[model samples]
Target: MKTKNNIRVGISIGDINGIGGEITLKAFEDSRMLEFCTPVIFASNKVIAFQKKHFGLEVNYNGVHEASQAVEGKVNIVNISKNAPKIEFGKETEEAGKYAFLSLKVAVEALKNNEVDVLVTAPINKHNIQSEEFRFPGHTDYLAKELNGEALMFMVTEDLKVGLMTDHIAVKDVSENITRNLILKKAAKIHDSLIRDFRIRKPKIAVLGINPHSGDNGVIGTEDDTVLKPAVAELFEKGIMAFGPYSADSFFGSDSYKKFDAVLAAYHDQGLIPFKTLSFGKGVNYTAGLDKVRTSPDHGTAYEIAGKGVADYQSFKEAVFTAIQIYRNREEYEELTSNPLKKASGNNR
Candidate 1:
């Protein structure tokens, strides 16, 4: 809820057995997060108790039943879980997945009801969450489906933004998925998001090819020449700054990616591999083209170092700050366009 200045952010506690709780505690360790916005963690008191003892960190926690009752002085938690499941650090269990799903569901619902301005998610284990109750591939898919299937996962650093044409698919199947319509749609979405969210008017996008050397002019493959080139050309005609059916081999090596605002990778690893290599711990995995603003750490749920108190909080901190920035930008844009007096205060000419 916004009261002229403060924005309330809903945080979903990710897998308890992973580094979700650990990094969450560490991320908000700074007092600056509370100054700009209030965070309500959709978790339980028992989960907090477990994390504090397991990580050997002392954090002042306040239990609140509703969003309005939350206090900015401490970490305000909504006690959603009645009985915290037996949490074993560094272990992936069905129970952990269930709680993670529950926390996210509560957070999403709160965001939908206008109780929160943005959603900041921690990491979750896909293997553990592939059960009867939770069948989504990951948080992006779940949020997309919940928000009427209008979201795409885009990874972002200060310098780079990477959007996947097809994520979480086998390398062999990636070729078939590179169609003209899909490419055009994702490219348009990326362009729109750059203008609306990132505030970039003429966002340049680099489209990577599916084959080596961009199909070597059809000698190696034809998808790059037939599908990618035509798709890019069509977007160009529409006045979008779309470039290249670039060869994946040389595109990232020469730092050619620095020329574009974002890269539309043909597949998952195509973009993420290089992105993670460049900005692994500092990057933010943002869900673009969504009706609601959402962001997560680029890394996954590190179950190995779950309760070790060694989980780095850099990415998580970045995600929260990014969400807050996007939310504020959106709010400002709305206010600027909606107020006729404010709009006229600038040059009418």
Candidate 2:
């Protein structure tokens, strides 16, 4: 497939009414983003203007109704709306949710149409984005359902890479969702993603035990032995390099996580607690296994700090860079796979 551009990135404005727009503008303040790829914003010019004015950001916007009008030096807006909702910092009204959802929809459509190479989403409010039209717990679940259930949420930091077997679920109901199929599926997605996106030839994945001490041989909890163990065994049979039903507590302390490319957790807090503690302001939330690349900051819409212009862009920066790296790696992988290798010349010599 011949793309019109080398790498056109589609950025979705998560919640214009919140700090999503501010940090997005801050991210674009680094003009070097143009060096990597063309970026198109799936947001209304009005929203961008409000954010720029409200937060005193200096970035310029060029309203483009389509991707064809995208150009460097200015933030290219797809102009999903000309007269969208006004800026109301820290608000979670339905209008904000609707706008955020529309932005994501446009970005996803652009990716599907090959108009963009990768996607980097800003933080969005889960409760506000869960209405009749945009009823989803979070971006991960929303994207997974939209992409025919192909995405898995993975938290990535410089030190730790974690995957939640279940994301955005109730703490009480986590055990009910911990079936062998679910565990294996999340593991397979993470494994394939490590190889295909991260370029890991052989991914070593660690599966965390749902109970303490990995159930102490079924003395603490049977799920760790019966459910997690069976899934790990199945993954091993499929030639996937995976291990454990490890005690979550010791898994991180022993520096055992250093040995694997990624760790699979049974639930949301199981994985995120450690990840966030280590990288509260710098973690990248990546949705792996999607046909197109997508990433976001691990944090949410900081309503308290809205319009303060103090929100750190480190996570956002990491996400954008990570997305670019993944896109390039996948592109390279496809190129190599499609071409044939040459035979050695030693015999002829």
Candidate 3:
């Protein structure tokens, strides 16, 4: 890892035709962003130049051949390809998918080697970015394989955090997937992330039920009562402050989610719909439980507004900030945990 003050942030430009380039450039236009971390964008200079010209933005960068050459306090462009693909705004092409994968592959390598302290990815089109090499549904699935630990799709804001028990799966499979072990694993990941990544001690987690109204005493579904309830009880017994199988329908609408440090929803839409509805432009999609820190904007490739310079860059900027904060928090967490007596005494303070 780099020095604490000079953490290197590796950025993989998402689909070339989308708002990835615009938002990324816009995020660093403030110049004060350099004080937070050194950004290494994994794309060619030609690609970046085209976006800069199109958006009419003035953000300077240092072009380099590799992440190792990235300099502190300056935006660095790690040239992955010399031949820049043709730009077709609001359109998805096989060429765009190829370059997207190339950028992501190189960036992940840099992350694995610790050339970059953290990764802040822009959104990619899931349908277009599919190939023989990249066969996963989304970043979370792919990252779980490339990175060290189980990946948890954690959508977060300062006051609200939501994690998915089963992501990128059909609704029909959600009930079958809600087993004791799955609940335990996801709950444990959320619990650990709250402490290490968010620096929340003794974090309270609420798990939303699999069925409506928590199955209404087994009328709608038995999985909530048979599987989810028991699993949550197990988590509590294991010393994790997890309580739930709470009705998903009213969890967020009733302001019940605000009571806990985080909420683990049974499936994707169950968690994300409410999360996005509440914190769409501001939320950061953090891949928690991974050895390396990774985060991305909550929104996707807004093809409808691509190249229009109308897409919001706040989420992308927040993702970058969140990745840096999580990296520093993990460092602090490791140091504190390494020294038991010091941690104990510090807790007392």
Which numbered prediction scores highest in lDDT against the true structure? Answer: 3
Clashing pairs in 1: none
Better of 1 and 2 by TM-score: 1
Instruction: Decide which is better by lDDT, 1 or 2.
Output: 1
Candidate 1: 10-residue stretch with minimal lDDT: 1-10
Off by over 4 Å in 1: 1-5, 339-349
TM-score of 1: 0.94
Q: Give the per-residue lDDT of model 3 (tens digit) for 1-349.
A: 4465598999999999999999999999989999889999999999999999999999999999999999998999999998989999999999999999999999999999989999999989999999999999999999999999999999999999999999999998888877899899999999999999999989999999988899999999798889988988999999998997899888899999889999999899999999999995899999999999999999999999999999899999999999999999999899899989989999999
List ranges where model 3 is wrong by over 4 Å.
Answer: 1-4
- Provide the overall lDDT of each model, using Cα atoms, as 2-decimal numbers: 0.85, 0.83, 0.93
lDDT of 3 at 22: 92
Error of 3 at 65 (Å): 0.2
Assess candidate 3 and give its lDDT. Answer: 0.93
The true-versus-predicted C-alpha distance at residue 301 of model 3, in Å, is 0.5
TM-score of 3: 0.98
